[model samples]
Target: MDERKLPSPCVVVLVGPGAAGKSTWAGERFAGELVVSSDRLRALVGAGEDDLAASADAFDLLEAVVRQRIGRRLTTVIDTLGLDRERRLRWLALAREHGMPCVAVAFDTPAAECRRRNRERVKRIPADALAAQLTTWNRVKKELPGEGFDEVLQAATEVRVVPEAFVQADAAVRREDAAPRGLRFGLQVSSYTHKGGRKTTGEWIRQVGARAEAAGFDAIYVMDHFRQIPQVGRAWEDFLESWTTLAYLAACTERVRLGTLVTGITYRNVAHLGKIVATLDVLSGGRAVCGVGLGWFEAEHKAYGWEFPSTAERYALLEDALQVLPVLWGAGNKGFSGKVLEVPDTTCYPRPLQDNVPLLVGGSGPRTLRLAARYADAANVFGDVTRVREKAEYLKAQPRQIELTHLSTTLIGRDQREVDALVNQLRPRNQDPARYAATANAGTITDQVGRFRALAEAGAAEVMFSLPNLDDDLSPLDTAGEVISAFR
Candidate 1:
């Protein structure tokens, strides 16, 4: 049998009559860890593989293990006869539920040959029983093609398995599915730096993360800076390291993606940053988005004793960081020779759970936009609706159509008076709120929804709402949730 590789992070199911060498074929083609065999599981459960009474318990274990592996987006192979259409459908449904592409490897060995092999087993089945199973296999093989499998491969004699074919197919499928899915809402919790009325405690941050997820926000972003941005609050204020904050948030919430609004590339070494993002993705079940940009804050850079390079030099460094990131995420130990960064050999162990962690590029400058077009999966802009539309249009004009996301400071309240008060409080602190007016997508539910509709119409695929105050009561999230539900 020629060795073949199946796609990584896929669900591969083997179908054949009993004694058709499914286990042997799976062993040859897949890693032992990747193959979930019913017979092996049955043996482990104090029931011999041939114990018909143990079949029920054996299959239950198999399904549980399959679900666990698929949930992790790991490549898994099921070694089973798969002769039952009802059972096959259940597995197919599970695959679809996880957004995993299913591949069927149907064995076409002659029934007589299968029976011959069965006779040599420690517990042989009756000839009549073997014949019935073979009859079922014959019919099942014909139906496997139409059973929602993304691809079907037939194994007649020597199983010819090519793993790269599966890899390519999986990549193609993800690329097709990666298109923007309507207008997503992300919550940018910026109140960590300052106290509106109450101190921002650890408990407060956790509550913010939990409430954001519960409110159905697609992602939660935190500013990546050593000190509070001057626009958010006084430059000298409480701040958390970007990756550490994301890691903490990753534990606090399960659904909403956690990442920096835009990680300043110079903050960490390119290799280390990639590892950090990959680790976060694994921890968050693939909910980490790598939002990176050229380091923009000169004050923080100087305060941290790091040199603040010129704009051209910073952009050059940003491009180098982008070049180094993908290789660290998935590429095995290999030399990465870039103009600004060089590595003799690099390997990021424990690859991210997501096949591709999305890269969001921030900023709207022409050079920044060009780098985004070249490397980013998404582009983020913060400004009025017209400015956002213009940046989105510029990105669209580029070769790649990156997902466009708009950032805004939200101040939603239950009523107009409450919202007006919050707006007034924010206006005193923020320097250019009136100038970048559309970036403040706030007010009552109706007002916020109206703004969301306008952003969506202007080609923004997502909007990140920055709440100014962090409260244990979660009134802001409750109000945001109401507006989010309207989009649904």
Candidate 2:
């Protein structure tokens, strides 16, 4: 679903038995032009789809189309049994020759299930042929990983092993009869593009903030990162400093709150973070939510010359930050001593405009959740509705109230057609569109309404979402506002 994974513009050979749901899988994820089906070709050229004399012509046409598509570096889904090792190797070689990544999607649908469906099909293959395909599938499933394909994924699971990628729990889609109430929404701007030229970037950022506020967003946040994070974008892309951008946004928009999605506790002096948050609060009329987390990106820390501490040490630093931020923003100077911080004097000039600035912890670990429950006002966690349900159960059990918030990267399209277009535009070439759509939580406006309603029912009091297309423009914010309005 993210860039660190193998996605698209590659040759995908479907490796499965008949009635394994191969074509059905491909049709849901791929466009007609992207899938080259041998059976379909046979049906077109022969007495019928099951015609034996047209087999040679069907395969020949399949190879010709695969060659042309690979030569052009376009994504192609080969809809065949894919049991022929020699044919699979040929396709792999063609992809490699064209500098494209070749993937083999082996369906894991059980043999019994295949047979059940095959029995139901009007044009079912002969039982012997089906049996042979199943035998071959059993052999090929074990061989796929060692084969030369870039990745071999089980079509049943929309996920493959990837670092830092989140696979959402399968939550049944159901809309609440009544709209949700008291659920807040915010927009987190993660990717910064240079598409509009360097000079136009500031204006674009302002528009994003203004549009988000107009769209009924309760707050607007930007990722506190020195470089573009790999999960969202590549390095060397445009990344504005977090607090300055928040200051600019605070000036551009009124009423909407401002904050960083999270600031790395290791990035700056703990006391300095308090000063920064305090200043933003005053300038933004008390609309500041300071999100802090144990910093983990060592590459950026090394690049910026900030010492990236061990996990324990980072948590220690975060604990001290959470304890001291309040004291620093209070009336009198105070001394604080903790695991990693020893502030002799917390003399902060120009105290925060709010009596108590809302501190939101941005991590989902048990220790982090406990820390939030003990000290922070709110906790922003990630994962699907199931994980949210688990975390919500834990946090709610605490003696004190801890607000629950969620960060979901949602793809909101007006309808299924627009959703499909964005899927084609954003999903990696090899990724199945249906899986990517589910992974991204991509859907129409009504679907998003139901999606957020599910999140709310799972105990998310507020949901901060980012649009896939918001990296360049504010087009979707207005539509997103409609979802926000439903909750209000």
245-323: candidate 1 lDDT, tens digit per residue: 8898889998988888899988888888888999999999899999999988998899889988888888888998877
lDDT of 2: 0.83
Residues 128-171 of candidate 2 have per-residue lDDT tens digits of 99999999889988988998788887786442211112112112
Task: Superpose all Cα atoms of candidate 1 onto the true structure and report the RMSD in Å to 1 decimal.
Answer: 23.4
Cα-based lDDT at residue 242, candidate 1? 77
Q: Count the backbone clashes (under 3 Å) in each candidate.
A: 6, 7
Best by lDDT: 2
Q: Per-residue error at 96 for model 2, in Å?
A: 32
Q: CA lDDT of each candidate? A: 0.76, 0.83
Candidate 2 pairs with clashing backbones = 7-428, 7-429, 7-430, 8-428, 8-429, 8-430, 9-429
**Model 2 CA deviation exceeding 4 Å by range:** 1-30, 33-175
